[model samples]
Target: MFLYMLIYLAYHGSRWIPRKQRLKFQIVNAVVITLVLVPQFYVIGRSKSSRYCKQPLLNNLSASIAFSFIASGFSVIFTLIEPIPQSLWASYHLFGLLSCGEGLCTTILTLTAKDCVKTTPELYYMSLFQTVASILSTGFFMVRGGLWLTKLNPGTDLSGNNESPAVPH
Candidate 1:
């Protein structure tokens, strides 16, 4: 989402802009990231997220934290561009674009499969999971964004708001 774009500024920003500048891009990004992460960490503390995670808690915690960080990135983007533009930049489609961006890393790795598979066998398999997650996420976003999922069945938002997608008719 737009919240993710705050990071774009942070990473792709100019080397130095100033108090002499008006709404300096770097300062705005720094403030946005700081403000967004504050609430995220607070939520992590209050929620029993770790306790509910699967056993061998360590492994699951890692996944949970990673997801939280991802969400935080999205939230930062959202903060920057809230009252989201109503054109083709709707949530589902934007997330689809983000998901495709996520896949790029694995895509590059995939292109060099033999080297990784031989060099670090476990990582090769692990990257497959990342690739699949990226594809499925993108598919979900696209389906909803393109209205295909809604067209398939009315009153189904896929977020459990209306009749469940699995509900018996």
Candidate 2:
């Protein structure tokens, strides 16, 4: 899906950007998400005279918070259970994929439903932004996780094979 592509693109692009600037990138991501969502909710909410219009934004905010909690919990579990080579980047990617899946499902459900209709570009863009944000956030976290892992276990084989200095995943 398109969300997956954005995650991967962001994930790989992280390599080109300086490590120190990642936090700033994340901040920009947060801002973009907010910018995209507010207008989107307004447009979508206004178009549908249904009572549900006012609720989607609230639902989305709650969902985002819940998603963050769930993603963090899963990441912690993975860090403790999986022999993930101390690469937080992998975790970030894993988390990003899960988040993207959540966003993708949410968008698909919203667009496909006849009961709740979004009749404007504003709403569509807002949905698109959330999807993109989900992907970017995941990508950022994965990259950060990988960087952390590498820092934690430098010169150690995370892949469990002692043959190569670093096991290629």
Candidate 3:
């Protein structure tokens, strides 16, 4: 639990780094994400670890889903905290990146740990489900925010065709 919190902090804290230092933050973000993913995969992959865990497989998967939702919430919180106007864009991008990273980490770990899952179709569906859910949730919030902005400033272009608003302090 402590390790997970540290990884979360590393990823979340990176947002506070100045723009000039963003590259460093990105690197740190990547490393920390990798660290968190390792344990996540270990818990999910079929093995003694999964079997010995207190909860059943369904419960474990549910917990994983909940974790992603919480991560999404954090992404939103971090975006709101950002001083820049384009923070939503950054947040969504980061959320997507984190989703993909976690999915890949789990998939690779599953395959490497065992050959029990034989069907590629099952994996495909699972991946699709995760991808769709992550995108829908993130996009929903982003669009909602945009709609609010448009409602607030009628003169500003509200159409989806309009270019993204410039970042202002």
Candidate 4:
């Protein structure tokens, strides 16, 4: 969820900056994001050392590492493709899809992990909240994309003229 939020913010927040400065900003953002994961890796290592290597704990640790690596790869790819205007939009769209998938998976896991929720009600609620938020944002993006496509290709008449409804001047 944190990863999703970070990606969301980075995607939208970078758009306003001048093109020349974006590369620098992205470099800094990548460094910060990678640095932030250090503590998480440490915590996971400590959990294992403390003999709390339960399935949930291990699953979370693995997911964290996997997500971190995937995010780093995305950062590299985005940096490489930044020069292409269309690539940026495509990246954002792909991220939206990824967020939706993640939300669905998280919701399913939360629903099925009855024991986990019973043991940790707070975590369950937090997971539910993240899932709901992701789904809402993804829905908004889908609707927005549909509207954009419609605007791009408004209906045409048989004469092949654009068929926007007549409007008074």
State TM-scores per candidate: 0.35, 0.37, 0.34, 0.54
Which of candidates 1 and 4 reaches a greater lDDT?
A: 4
Candidate 3 per-residue C-alpha lDDT over 28-101 given as tens digits, one digit per residue, 9 for 90 to 100: 55565465455455445634433332223324354555565555455334434545457654655565565555
| Candidate 3 accuracy as lDDT | 0.48
lDDT of each: 0.47, 0.51, 0.48, 0.59
* Best of the two (2, 3) by TM-score: 2
Stretches of model 1 off by over 4 angstroms after superposition? 1-68, 72-99, 148-169
The best candidate in terms of lDDT: 4
lDDT per residue (tens digit) for residues 102-153 in model 1: 4664555555564545444444444555556556655554655678645666
Clash count in backbone of candidate 2: 10
TM-score of 3: 0.34
- On the 0 to 100 scale, the lDDT of residue 140 in model 2 is 68
Model 2 agreement with the true structure over 12-86: per-residue lDDT tens digits: 444455666666655544554455345544654554433454225435545655654444344334323323355
Q: Sort by TM-score, best first: what order? A: 4, 2, 1, 3
Pull out the clashing pairs in model 3.
none
For candidate 4, which ten residues in a row score worst on lDDT? 46-55
Winner on lDDT between 1 and 3 is: 3
Which runs in model 4 stand beyond 4 Å of their true positions?
1-12, 27-61, 76-81, 85-99, 118-126, 155-169
Root-mean-square deviation per candidate: 15.4, 10.5, 12.9, 6.2
Candidate 3 Cα errors over 4 Å, as ranges: 1-12, 49-54, 65-81, 84-169
Q: What is the lDDT of residue 163 in candidate 1?
A: 71
Clashes of each: 5, 10, 0, 0
